[model samples]
Target: MLEVSAAREIVLRHAKRLKADFTALMSSSLGQVIAADVASDVDSPPFDKSLMDGYAVRAADVSPTAELTVVEEIPAGKMPTKTVGPGEAVRLFTGAPIPPGADAVVMREKTDSPSADRVVIREVPTAGQFILRQATEMKVGETVIPAGTVLTPATFGLLASVGKTTVPAYPQPKVAVVATGDELVEPNRRPKPGQIRNSNGPMLTAQVALAGGLPRYIGIATDREDVLRSYIAEGLEIANVLILAGGVSAGDFDLVPKVLKDCGVTAHFHHVKMKPGKPLLFGTKGDKLVFGLPGNPVSSFVGFELFVKPALRVMGGHIDPPTATQKLTLSEPFAANNNRPTYHPAKRDGDGVRGLKWFGSPDLRAMLDADAFLVLPPGEVNYAAGAVVEVLPINRTAS
Candidate 1:
């Protein structure tokens, strides 16, 4: 059996970044990677602009106190009709263009308009105060967002500022989720004895989307080799990653590994020494990845977070995605499995992490309020409250 780190490393070795680029609307590119550097088409602020609603005047005209002639009023989006000379000012609102010959802006609260054509200044003004100069933020043809940058709301805003309606970005990988087993039935149908609802398919689809991949759900595949082959062939043809839940453990019905090999997928690793995810299988063919996850819902859940998410990051153009782990004290005592490292479903308390009431691998109810998983290393250990432990947070924000 491979160690967790070793298995993960092997998975990443096969995760090649897709080099092709496609044009997509800026609004749809959030949380995606840019394929090429994007340059600004126009200078930011293009002209001298005002940062406040005030009088634009010569600095010497408002040294502590002065009364000045109000030449014109410049509202936002309206050009100034008059230039301010000595003892003169232009009334300007926020975001209005700074008029010619105006060097400073004194806030309206600091000055009073005694008459329609005249104004009084009560505060001194300095040169360039409240003035946004042309090209100060960005120049035309400058690189606004570099290549391989992960798109965020702020980045999209920046691109919009440069008049970019579309951007060259890498497409999110399309993942196919397939559930296996003749013992499985869709949630819409009531299951007979010795049968179970196919929860892994929907759960894995959600996981794929959360990791920034587009998920396509393929219905359950039965245990027969012919049925498995048909589903596997369809998945491989349509998606960049094919994820089949179950039929991976050593059993008479364990037909996924053999069928996948026949379909040209080279298996990288078959087992990992981790609780709940021991029978995780990873393979590749051409540019696509295939994962055969254990049938247990919690095992499938843990397997995706530990093995698949990192591969998605690399394929999405991240050089080094951070592991979302933190150290916290345990809020309650826990007695975990000692044969292998286990990740117990946990919730964040006010000042610590607390494990939930759980039964080994098959207990999906334990994950109801779980926001993280507490990592328990292999040992015959009884941890008391307040014992420091590491946890991996789920549903991390995209930045």
Candidate 2:
């Protein structure tokens, strides 16, 4: 079996980024990756503006006990009509343009207008205080957002500030999730004796959506070769990426790998040296990619995170497709079963990681309290408390 890192390298080597397309800037654009660098058409703050609603004054003319003439009042979004001279001040609100000849601003709280057009400077003012200089925040034609950047709320605001109504971005991939097993039934129906409701189908669909891919839950495929072949062919025709849960292990009823080969998918790797998801399969045919995950819920989940998630991210034009990993101290002692690397579900406790109660690969409930997985490599066992370990965050990128 291939090591975890080798498997990941193979998947990334086969996965290629999709073509860029123009998309309108809307709420739905969130989480989409940019295809090109976005440059600002104009400078932010556009002109010399006010940072606060205060008096714009010539700093040299203001003293501890000097009273200045209020020459003009400037509100936000309006240009200043008069400039400040010696012993003069301008009443300005926030975001208003700084008037000419004004080097600083004295806040209203620091100055008192004892009479109309007359103001008393209670505090001495410094030059260029409370004023935002033009082009200081962003220069004209500066690159505001770079390529491969994910569009978040703050990024959307930045794009809007630069008048980017239509953005060029890589389109999200359409994923088809197919679960194969004769013992599997729909979630709405109770399973008969020796049968189980299909959890991998819904779980895989949700996982695809969370990774910014559009998911379609193709119905479950029975163990029969004909039925599995039909579903696999249909998935390939409709979706850019296909995910098949179960039927990849070395068993008589496990027939997904064979069916995928019959449908012309060249196998990349069939097994990895990792617990819970060792029977992971990755393949490609033409422009589409396929993942044959293990039947166990935890195995399927881990396979998607370790292999498929990065592929989806790469297709969306992310420069760094792999989810980030962190090194954290283990709060308690733990051990591994075999020589293969093990991913133990864990939670953050204070500043360290605490392993949760994990029964096996099929125990999906144990994952509810897990925010990350403590990765234990081969031949390493008998970890003591406070041992530093590498952690891969679950369901989100590590910070």
Candidate 3:
């Protein structure tokens, strides 16, 4: 029975950052953490340009009822050809380069086109009007996107604006799921007496993929030391994380601890003082993370959210891990007191969270309609209605 803080500390101390490579284009880099700071190679909008489709002219030439001769027309993408001289103007389009010696631009709507060669200005335009200065968006050699920034679509557009084609990011972590149970058969296979088709395997596999990790299904292992050790050894060779299911409890046939001990794996914490997932095990074999979850389907899912998701983020070089803890009012009273911290699958309705009624750990039926969990800490009589309590969302939007 370990405190929550103590358990977190143990997991952090025992965890190791993953060693892998990842590089992709900025468009494909969404949700990935940047490994290096993104610097602008050149000034954004590189040169002084016009921000409006108008006439580029010297500010001195602009006056009420003054007429200036149009010397040249400049469109976007091509450089300006003529310099704006006294009593001279250039027709410019949006994004066109400002011609030399031009200090202001008058909107076309403001000026009357008396003739094709000459234009009369009814309004006086001020200096620097409709001009976008160079390097206004970003400066050259300045860091635009810093390291550890989780790239989104907006960030990707920013990177592209700064002329970054490819991006450097930490590779997605490779997770190997080892579901150890003698009574568990494969999901596609039919189950016999005293056998249950493995639900944790497919569930955890999908969970890993959702967490931005590559999931490798290593199949099930019998509750025997030799078979479990062989599977673990194989997992250690290629996976950054080895997730073991159904062999962490203090049951007679739990062989995960013995196998890890024999393989010289370091155990951070064997048990956490949390209901539905008390027997969670966090360990490491060199740089690989080893997470052992309980046998129950519901407990396995909860353990992945509580432990494995954050661990994967840290290993993937993300500065901030996924978090879902938020304060919400409880719609019903909770009965689990001081014995352990309880995380009951719940649904959020309006402004409050309602914990569902179900048989404790092994019950997976209540979770189908559950959106999150109404978390209750130790040493509490009950959470009365209208009390603010922390809730951890288990839905996809939480991360």
Candidate 4:
């Protein structure tokens, strides 16, 4: 069995960043990663413009309590017909182009308008006052958005400002999730005495989306080889990654490994030495990746967090994955003597974290308040309150 760190390293070694495909429309490029530097088509502000509704005056001509003749009036989006000369001013609104020969602006409140054509300067004007200079934010042909930038709403607006209608970007990877077991039923159906509802399928799908991959739930597959083989083949064709929940342990009915091999997937490692998620199987066929997660819901969730989420992030060109481990103090005393390292569910308590109610890996209900995982090392351990331990944040806001 491979260690958790070793298995994760193997997965990342195979998860190469996608190449740039230069046809991503800005309309649909949200959450996509930029493949190349986006250059601005024109200077930001385009020309020297007014920053406020005030009088544009020659700086040398405006003195304290000096009167000046109004040469012209320029509103936003309009040009100034007359330029300000000596002892002259132009009445311009915000965003209007600065009239020639005018070096500063005085707000209306700072000036006394004795008549429509003349104004008294109550304050001395300074050069470049209330002026937004051309190319102040960005110049033409300069890089507006750098490579590897993730597209957000604000970045989208920046792209539009730079006249970038389309960008070279790497889109979210498509992931297919399917559960395998004979005693499984959909959530809508009432399970019989020997059956239970399938929560792993939908839960893994949600995890995939949270990890920046587009998830497609492929329903469930029974214990039969024929059915499992069909689902694996279809997932391989449609998705960049395929996650099969269950049928990975050493049972006679555990047919995921054999079926995946028959479908041309080359296994890299199987069975990680981690609690709640030991029966993880990883493989690849060409550029497509495959994962066989444990049947238990909590184990499946942990497997995605440790391995699959990082793979999806790599495919989407994201540098930071969700498995950000931090060392934090435990808020309460706890004891565990597990042979394997445990990632127990936890919630933030004040500045530290406290473990939640848990009863082994199958207790999916305990994960309801799980924002982080308290990493407990293997071997006999008794931790006192305020003991510092490793913590993995699954939900950033919750932690």
Leading candidate by TM-score: 2
The residue-by-residue lDDT of candidate 2 on 1-399, one tens digit each, is 899889999998887888899988887777889999999999888989888888998888777978988888889978988878998888999999999999898888898889879999898889989999999989889998999888888888998899988899998888999999999999999999999999999999988988888899999999999999999999999998999999999999999999999999999999999987999999999989999999999999989989999989888787773867898888888876656788878898878998899998999999888888888777758889989989988775311
lDDT of 1: 0.88
Per residue, candidate 1 scores C-alpha lDDT tens digits across 1-399 of 998888988988899887757765655567788888989889888889999999999996676669999999999999887778988999999889999999999899999888988999998888999999999999999998998888888887887798877777777888999999999999999999999999999889888887878899989999999999999999999999999999999999999999999999999999999998899999999999999999999999999988888888778776555356789999999776568988889999987999998887899998878989998898776889999999988774443
Query: Against the true structure, what is each candidate's TM-score?
Result: 0.94, 0.96, 0.86, 0.93
Please give the RMSD to the true structure for each candidate, in Å.
Answer: 1.9, 1.7, 3.2, 2.2
Model 4: runs farther than 4 Å from truth?
26-28, 332-334, 349-351, 396-399
TM-score ranking from best to worst? Answer: 2, 1, 4, 3
Alpha-carbon local distance difference test for all models: 0.88, 0.89, 0.83, 0.89
lDDT by residue (187-218, candidate 3, tens digit) is: 78899999998888888998887787788999
- Candidates ranked by lDDT, best first? 2, 4, 1, 3
Model 1 residue runs over 4 Å out of place are: 320-324, 396-399
How good is model 2 by TM-score?
0.96
For all candidates, the clash counts are 0, 0, 1, 0
Model 2: how far is 112 from its true place, Å? Answer: 0.7
Pairs of residues clashing in candidate 2? none
